[model samples]
Target chain A: MQEVLRAHLEQIIPLTDEEFTFIESHFILKKYKKHQFLIQEGMPVKYVYFVVSGLLKLIHTDDTGKQQIISFAMEDWWESDYQAFYTQTEATFSLDCIEDSVVLGLSLESYQTLCEHLPKMEHFFLQKANRGYMALQRRLLSLMTSQAKERYQQLIHQYPTLVQRVPKTLLASYLGVSRETLSRLSFGV
Target chain B: MQEVLRAHLEQIIPLTDEEFTFIESHFILKKYKKHQFLIQEGMPVKYVYFVVSGLLKLIHTDDTGKQQIISFAMEDWWESDYQAFYTQTEATFSLDCIEDSVVLGLSLESYQTLCEHLPKMEHFFLQKANRGYMALQRRLLSLMTSQAKERYQQLIHQYPTLVQRVPKTLLASYLGVSRETLSRLSFGV
Candidate 1:
């Protein structure tokens, strides 16, 4: 699990043994069972999790209790109620495991300290942030301009494994389509 | 205009006169007339513009030549075909002035030089990128979950001036509503 964290970091910036050790000290490994909540709406977001294994879903529940899937995290991906994590506010979303999972958790304090002490880590985070922004921009554009079928096709093309792992009902929510519509599209009926 | 850039930077990280001067040198001041393009589809994105004054729109045109407004950038906001700018690829979208605009443009090379030579600049960029990602996430959620009217309301509440400055047609496009629907909603009819 620690090796997974080190490998993830090394993907962006080369880390010396001592630097990797220092970086590792800032993260805590945690495991969660399937359906376990890692973050709950209205609770403080204590840490951002980087998935070492398994799957998690981030969702928002409306006043009417309708759940909207915001995103999913799998191996090597990061997840959090980032608005809460960054601002130290209560979460407006919840994160729950879809599979028994292992993750590396970094608290806000540790995040700041790592950036302050390791310039390369700051660069690494900046790259990740920029890529995250770009991904969201692409998603926004797809939502604005693409139809449900196109979006589903995009999801399948981008992450076939994700499409396979996510239940059809959840995938329908993520695509902003009804389960029936998803079924029709998926089956080409 | 330089003061505007300096002020924007200082909002995140305080900088000395010498530091500001060094920072300012990496940017080039450029002015565009209304409807002038700062970036065009299929052209290499050379710089990311930080608006000193006036307005800009980032748009993508589909195969049918129907345009989708990705976002509006006003004074103190940054706008670019960021995917193209970061990846050094041809832009899939175009950025054009809505009003006669002045902006400070930072090239990729200068961006890299600034980040490498000034660690604080890297931190500043990381902050900006993270905030941009959060903003995009919020917009994506709104697009996925909110009705057109709710999305319109969210936009107006978030950027009242932007709502006023953008034409109703573009506003409708941004909210993913028809122009007639926007007219009806705006007038509460």
Candidate 2:
């Protein structure tokens, strides 16, 4: 499990055995059953989770009780209500396991301490944040310009495994289309 | 103009005069008239601009030649085809001035050297990137869950001055609504 995290970090920055050991000490490992909530809307977000295995979805429920899929995270990916986690505020979104999942969680204090103690970790995180920002920017552009069918095709092209793993209804919600529309589009393709 | 850059940096991390001077030396100041392109689509993105005065719009043109407004950057904000800037690729988006604008431009090499030589600068940039990511996440959620009128309202509430500054058609483009729809929404409000 720890090796999963070490490998993720080392992708952006080289880490020594000692440094990886130091970094690993700050994380607490936990497991959840499918459909269990890692973060509940309106509850304080205590930690950010890095998945070692399995999958999760980040969801926002609007005032009218319509649920929107913000994103999905699988193995080696990080998931959190990041605004809530960073600001120590209550989560406006929820994160739930799509599969039986194991994750390494890091508290805000521990995150700050890790960066303070090891500057390279800060650099590594910065790179991750930049990449995340770029991904979201692309999503925003797609939302602004692409039709539902086009978005579905783009998603499938970008993440064929994700298209296969995610349920059709959830995929529809993520693509901002009706399940009927998604079915038609998928069939048409 | 350099003071604007210094103040922006100091918002996240305080710097010594000598350090500020060193950082300022890496950026070049340039001015552009309204409608001038800071970055052209399919051209190599050379610099990320920090707005000292006036406003700029980042735009994406679809294959059908429909233009979508990605975002607007004004005083104290940084704008670029960041995907291209960081990766050193040709820009898929173009940035153009909405008003005669003065900006300080930082090349990728200077950006990297600044981060490598100053760990605190890296921390500052990490904070900025995290904030940018959070902002984009909120926009994505808005795009997913909100009605066009609701999105228009949210934009007005968040950036009232921006609404007043940007043209109605561009504002409509940013909100993913037609110009007539925006006018109706604005009038209704």
Candidate 3:
């Protein structure tokens, strides 16, 4: 699990063994069963998780209890109610497992400490944040420009693995389409 | 203009005079009138801009020449075809002034040099990126969950100044509604 983290970090910034050890100290490993909640809505978001195995969804539940999957995270991905985590506020979104999962969790304090102690980690995180920002920008643009069926096709074309793994209902929510509409489209596709 | 950039950077990280000078040297200031294009679709993106004054819109034009606004930027904000700028690819979106604008343009090479030479800049950029990601996430969620009327209300409530500054057609484009609908809604409000 730690090796997975090391490799993920190395993808952006090479880490020395000693540096990796120090970095690893800031994170605690945790495991969850499918459907177990990592961060619950309205509760304090304590840590941001880096997935080691399995899959998770960042979910937003509306006033009527309609749950929407904002995004998904699998192995090598980072998941959090980020606005809440960064601001130390109550989680607006809940994170839960789509499969039995293992993750390395880092608290806000630990994240700040790590960056302060090793500026290289700041560089690493900046790279990650920039990439994440770019992704969100693309997603926002897609939402603004594309129709539901087009978005579904775009998702399938770009993330065939994710499309295969995510349940249709959740995918429908993510794509802003009705379940029946998604069903018809998926059947046709 | 340089002071505006310095003040924006200082909001995240303190910079010495020497440090600010070093940072300023990497940016080139340019002015554009309303409707002038800072970036055009399919052109190689050369710089990521930090707005010193006035407003800009990031726009996407579909095959039929219909345009949709992806986002807007004002004084103290940053705007770019970031996907293109970062990847060194031709821009899929165009950025143009909505108001007579002044911006500091930082080339990718200069960006790299700034981050490498002054790691604080990386931290500053990380903070900005995180905030941008959160904003995009909120926008995406709103697009998924809200009706056009509700989104228009939310925008008016959240960004009153922007609502006042932007034209109805662009606002309608941003809200994914027809101009007539937006005009009716605005008149009622």
Candidate 4:
């Protein structure tokens, strides 16, 4: 699991053995059962989790109690109620495991201190943030322009494993389509 | 214009006169008339722009040739065909002026060199990217959950001046509403 974390970090920036040791000190590994909440709406977001195994969903529920999936995280991906995490405010979103999961959680203080200790880590996180921003931009554009069928197809093309791993109902929510429509699309009806 | 850029940077990280001078040197100042293209589809994205004054729209045209407004960038905002800018690839989106505009453009090479020269700038950019990502999360969630009218109202509440400044047609396009529907919503019918 620690090797997973080190490998993910090394994908962006090469890490010395000592540097990896220092970075590893900042994170705590946690295991969660399926459907376990890593973050709850209205609680302070304590850590940004990097998934070492299994899958997680970050969701926002509206006033009518309808849940909209904002994003899904799997191996090597990061998840959090990011605005709350960054601002030290109450979370407006919740993160829950879709499967029994293992993740490395890094608190905001450790993130900042580690960045200060290693400017290279700051660069690594910067790249990660930029990539997240880019992915969101693409998603926003897709939502604005593409139909649900196209979105699902694009998703399948991009992450066939994700399509296979996630349940059809959750995939429907993520694509903002009804389960019936998703089933039709999935079955090529 | 340089002072405006300096002030924006200072909002995140304090800087000395010498530091500002070094930072300012990496950017090129340019002015565009309304409807002028800052970036064109299929062209390489040369820089990411920070608006000093006026407004721009980042647009994506679908296969059917209908344009989608990805976002509006007004004073003090940053806008670009970001994926293309970061990856040094041909742009799929076009950035054009909505009003006569002044912007400071930073090329990728300059950005990397600047961050390397001043590690604080790396932190500054990281903060900016995180904020962008957080904002996008809110937007994606809204797109999934909110009606066009609610989205329009949210936009008005967030940026009253922006609502007033932008044309209604573009606003309709941005909100993904028909112009007539937007007019009715605007009139509170």
How many residue pairs collide in each prediction?
A: 0, 0, 0, 0
Q: How far off is residue A45 in model 3, in Å? A: 0.2
Where in model 1 is the C-alpha error above 4 Å?
none
Cα lDDT, model 3, residue A160: 90
Better of 1 and 2 by DockQ: 2
Expressed as tens digits, the lDDT of each residue in B1-189 for candidate 3 is: 688888889999999999999999999989999999999999999999999999999999987788888899998889898889999999999999989999999999999999999989988988998899998899988887887888999999989999999988899999999999999989878
When 2 and 3 are scored with TM-score, the better candidate is 2
Error of 1 at B54 (Å): 0.6
**Residue range B43-157, candidate 4, lDDT tens digits:** 9999999999998899999999999998999999999999999999999999999899999999999999999999999999999999999888877887788998899899999
Candidates' C-alpha lDDT = 0.93, 0.94, 0.92, 0.94
True contacts kept of each: 0.92, 1.00, 0.90, 1.00
Which docking band does candidate 2 fall into? high
Instruction: Report the error of model 1 at residue A43, Å.
Output: 0.5
Better of 1 and 3 by DockQ: 1
Residue B62 CA displacement from its true place in model 1, Å = 1.1
TM-score of each: 0.98, 0.98, 0.97, 0.98
Clashing pairs in 3: none
Q: What tens digits encode model 2's per-residue C-alpha lDDT throughout B1-189?
A: 889889899999999999999999999999999999999999999999999999999999999999988999999888999999999999999999999999999999999999999889889889989999999999999888889999999998989999999999899999988999999999999
Report the interface RMSD that candidate 1 achieves against the true structure, in angstroms: 0.8
